[model samples]
Target: MIILHNYFHTFPEFPPECEFKYAPENVSRFTEAMLSGNLRIIILSLFSFLGHYGVSIFVFVSGYGLSKCYDHSGESKWYIILRRAIQLWKWLVPMALLLILDRYSGYTHFTYAYLGNNKIWTDMLFMLTFTANGLADRFIIAGPWWYFGMAFLLYVIYALFLRKSSDKVLWGIIAGVWTLLIVLSSLGLDNWVFAFRYNSIGWLPVFCVGILLSRHPVYISWRWISLGVVLFVLSLFNRYLWVVSPILALFPVAAVLPLARKEPLQNVLLFMGKLSAALFVTHAFVRQQVLAHDQALPPEISGLLYLLLCIVVAWVYRLCLTCFYKKIHL
Candidate 1:
């Protein structure tokens, strides 16, 4: 779904006026599609819906896994925070070096694509350390790296508050936080990309759903699936709710629970799951090379080639990562 946007969202046939429309405003492709009356854009916008939901599911699953493992006990809060921080930066440090090298060497243009100013290092340190993503979006060396900042923010929230809360207190906290968010969003906070897509507070509702489910495991029956579909459909009706479609989009993953026991399909699923973060972290670099240099290739063929290249690169990335860590003995 995300690859649909990454590889195939070039609406090259747009009228001249709309060619570079969304760039100045920092609006997303989804918003561009929503506002554009072009039929092709509207149809392709479904990919936006499905693709962005991946982050929501990722956060939710992170919350679930944390709750299941810790259950509000064990490690000290700072220890948990330190551990998560290491995990985030271990990837960022190497990836940042690769990006800087790419920028200086590629065209020898001395122009950094997303690295912008040298302040990226400072920005990343503060962002990754604190996950104060409101300021952290400026550290947009890789566009998707915003999620790492947000993920750490969520982790901090988990370590500091969530790990100690009772179920009732947790639900109340979720409601209270969202109520504040709704009011702030009504006052136009959603216009900021950070608040709209990268804020831990905005993401908390979905994450809390995972925590609750982990605390009280539920059966994934057809009725629950039906309810999930219904709520997801309803979320599309309202603008604010529509922003959280990821939460609603999460229900369908339950339908795939049975796949864990299947044959090659299970192996495929596990492989992708293990490599998903590596794929996301590295794909933008691969994409820059793929899309920029795929000269005059057919769109369908180029798209497939790009996808294949991403998986291959991600596998290599995984191997390199494991070897590096083993060498360091961390």
Candidate 2:
């Protein structure tokens, strides 16, 4: 999304039909469908259904990787947390630049794009403080920001509370909290703003599963196929049951990573994993750029073109990040 937007902004070959059309109703429904879908399928469906949710797997895997590395090295807590925060800054700084350019280029409407101009303070908080879910609630709705923000929050919380906690106690507490949130969401008793706004609670379950995996790795084969099957079945139902989707999404973790491990394709998977974040942020922009340049393409073709661009943008962005990381001293 980010790539398309950036491309179209600079090219300006095809102007999109720009009469403002709000899709809040559709968004709300899709959000619900995401939550209620089948366990494994929800994970896979996002890759095809909307494409954004595929990165959630990366978020979990990233958390798992960070935790695993920290455990192996026995790094100081302060140092580890600082490093994680720095990684975030590494990505966000560039994004901030793009964000500013995106606005200046007229690819994005700063006023309406950000929930009225007065909410700049809130948006900055989300961007700076890592309250992505909060930002989604206030300005955007259910974008890739939520995954990064929520993952940051989980890392902080886990480091403070569960890093050295007994596995039994930590897993129990994690599952219990997830269960409570699920109950609240199902009952509509959740303080949606508080739960999602600060990135305090929405994705705890997924991250917690990753945390658990850090302690107790699952052993399995042919997991991705199983995950694909499950994800497909779940898409038929719905993805909107606030608490169910994340829980269902966990099954793939058991299946997908193990399969990846068994395959002798470490570098390729790592490359894809590393670029996952950049891809998540850029794909939407790429799609928008295509639409802007060739407005007459049918929506169906536009969607296909968007998917292809997502892959291209993600790969390109990954290469850029790799180069930047090597060139910079940090």
* Per-model RMSD to reference: 4.9, 7.9
Q: Model 1, 1-330: lDDT tens per residue?
A: 565455454435221111101122323444566678876556545553445566778889999998987775678989988988888777666776776675557464222356546666676566556554666334366666677878888898899888878888878867776576556656665445345455677778788989999989877779988788788766655545554566678876766667767988899878888878788788776776776778587655666787888899889888898899999897
Per-residue lDDT for 100-196 in model 2, tens only?
5545664554312433355454565666677656543343421345555666777787667657766687567556765665455456553542455
Q: Score each candidate by Cα lDDT.
A: 0.67, 0.54
**Candidate that scores best on TM-score:** 1
Please estimate how well model 2 matches the true structure, expressed as its whole-model Cα lDDT: 0.54
RMSD after Cα superposition, model 2: 7.9
- Runs off by more than 4 Å, candidate 2: 1-56, 102-122, 140-142, 190-200, 220-244, 252-271, 318-325
